[model samples]
Target: MQAVMKNVDCIIEVHDSRIPFSGRNSEFEYTIGGRPKILILNKADLADMSCRKQVVDKLKRDGCSRVLFSDCKHDSTNIIKKILPSIQELIHDAGRYHRAENRDYNVLVCGVPNVGKSSLTNAIRHKYLRAGKATQVGPTAGVTRSVLEKIRVCDEPLTYILDTPGVLAPNVRNVEVGMKLALCATLQDHLVGETIIADYLLYWMNRHRRFEYVEHFGLKEPTDNITELLVPIAIHSNKIQKIRTSEGRYEYKPNISQAARVVMAAFRTGKLGKFMLDDDALDSLSEPAVADNAGDARHRS
Candidate 1:
């Protein structure tokens, strides 16, 4: 991150607004330190608007640098256009004053998993005439691999971009959370594994959602509680070779094996109703007051 920031005049931190906290790589903050940065909240369409409002408010109080909401999956070029000129100026100044070499300014695009970093890169690549380079193409045709990738959008008026992987934080618990992050590394297009886990939990939450959970599992009896219904399901599915509950009425064994299968299925499919693991309010940081000089130093000093 530090190298990218040092290489580029401006650093844009892209993140999924739905899971801001999850998407943020705390380490990057230390790497970039206080370099001129723009916080981009991507996938705004999937996130909660009220929460984003709060995050915007909060960002303002925390130095109010710059924040933009975007939907990379859709048309979000307007926001990029608004921020581009100032960013270009910052790069130009860096190349002219800060750097000793006659090279173009680099702009690093850093973000967490599935936040649309690649999509955003493509968007910017389309606009700028001198766009440096679109992610360095590897030897393999059509197959893409992640390795601190970079793209050149322009030549004479140079501006390079580095696309980073999803941020990984220690605070992130749950194996499912990790699996979701796996979307960054794996080639699979669907979040099948995450959905399987989610479907299981959702099954418990809403029994009606999955007919197999109750019908094929012999849980049709209205009197059967969650555990009771689960045991037979697990036994029938061969998840457990054998089943033996405690002999006494005082003891009851809840069925976890069945739940495990459900969880496993969620992971196999991205069926979990567009789950956003991160707190949405992280974007509520207030907008910083617009710079007074519209002509000068819009993003960097």
Candidate 2:
């Protein structure tokens, strides 16, 4: 998907604000290589607010001009206005250099599946066309290809809008890549390996955003970590009865889904504290497509 953008004069890279890092294509950096690019962090409503703040801070530190956190379903009049100047500048510069016969600017928008690229395009096109422009969002598991030839934007009749397929991590050849991808894709699920990740979360909350948790949950400082402090979550999960383990340890496995539900709810309700899972996390991951091309080119040469 990133390679395809090279043909365009400007590339708008879209990402889900909730899990920005996970959806990033490893090959994208190599493709853009610091070209004129716009980073759109879509689906902000589903994300943790603290995470959004951290992302905004990182982008500001990096001197990025275009950064927006918006849900696709809501009105985006302001965001559209913000993007207009940049897109116009790109088109203007390209037009100035082109001969009379060749005066078209291609603006390409690309992003991962379910990141709300289609909805964004519709919103953009509607604002430009001043009509009810409609675009369909495809399914998560499948790719939907559609072409709406030329969409007039700001009276620029030749701007072409292209919607591409979602890009997912290619199959890992070994455990190394698999593990790396897993770490990139999912947060440390405090529910899966309960005794382990729960402990980590507790430690993180206490050390980093201590005040919020204490005041909000009314939680007492634990002598240990989450595994040692199951009373609160256990009660929340309605685990009325606690039994002794076969080896003589207290066993409490609250409702299987309770922990996850709680964590997600707390995150939604502003209880888990503001956190960012994308920005720096995204900068740390491997750039996509670098591992294959160099070797193939050398062999061919």
Candidate 3:
């Protein structure tokens, strides 16, 4: 990442809108210091939009002056329209040094895994260049394995973007944050265990009193025990497996793993309901001193 930092005129960091505050890699802030940066909260369509303004206001207070909500799956988003203009303004304010004589601009696109970095890149390319996809995109994380050469997305201003692989922080702040990342598919599900992720989802939903999952999964009532909850879903969905017993007899059992995957898929695809996992974090932003202190600690680290 440092190798191309000097060449970048602007940096666009993409992150999951559902986890606005929990799983961001603060290391990028230090790496892209002094460079014009924009925070694109991708997958806005899947996030709870009731507190959208509050999220934007909180981000600005935390020094992210330019925050845009975007849904890269769509052909056109207002945020996509504003990106080029915003970058142009930033470049004009902070004149390029190495490429001062050059008319074209190079911007670096980066973020953690599964945050729609490549999707956003392709969306921009389609919007500006009227071109096909320039970068590969996938449902799982870490699709772009390495930084690639510049891909032109615009012609009038000759704008190109350097696509980089998703890089996560070395250490997640806490177990809850790690689970949140896993829930969003930012982290590989196998690494964290499917059942564990499902458990966290249940815990978070119950904590917030969001019982949409009960109706979505056809459960009569909510239950804290993951096994009990998953058994009903497994039966409802006919996700059953046959197992051999020690006595050489076969028995039918609930496919808990399959049921867990179903639950996780519902959460990710918003079948359960739109939610902001960082809602509690945003609420805490009301206290200025607490937010300031947390921001300072992240910068220092």
- Quote each prediction's TM-score: 0.55, 0.54, 0.91
Candidate achieving the largest TM-score: 3
> Across residues 142-176, which tens digit of lDDT does each residue of candidate 2 receive?
24354322344545645556665554433344443
* Model 3 stretches with alpha carbons more than 4 Å out: 75-77, 287-301
lDDT of 1 by residue, 42-96 (tens): 7665554555556776666655457888765565447755556667665555454
lDDT of 3 by residue, 90-133 (tens): 88888787679888889998888889989898888888888898
Better of 1 and 3 by TM-score: 3
Best by lDDT: 3
Candidate ranking (lDDT, best to worst) = 3, 2, 1
Better of 1 and 3 by lDDT: 3
> How far is 111's C-alpha from truth in model 3 (Å)?
0.4
Off by over 4 Å in 2: 2-7, 16-26, 33-35, 43-77, 94-106, 112-119, 129-160, 168-203, 210-224, 227-253, 268-273, 277-301
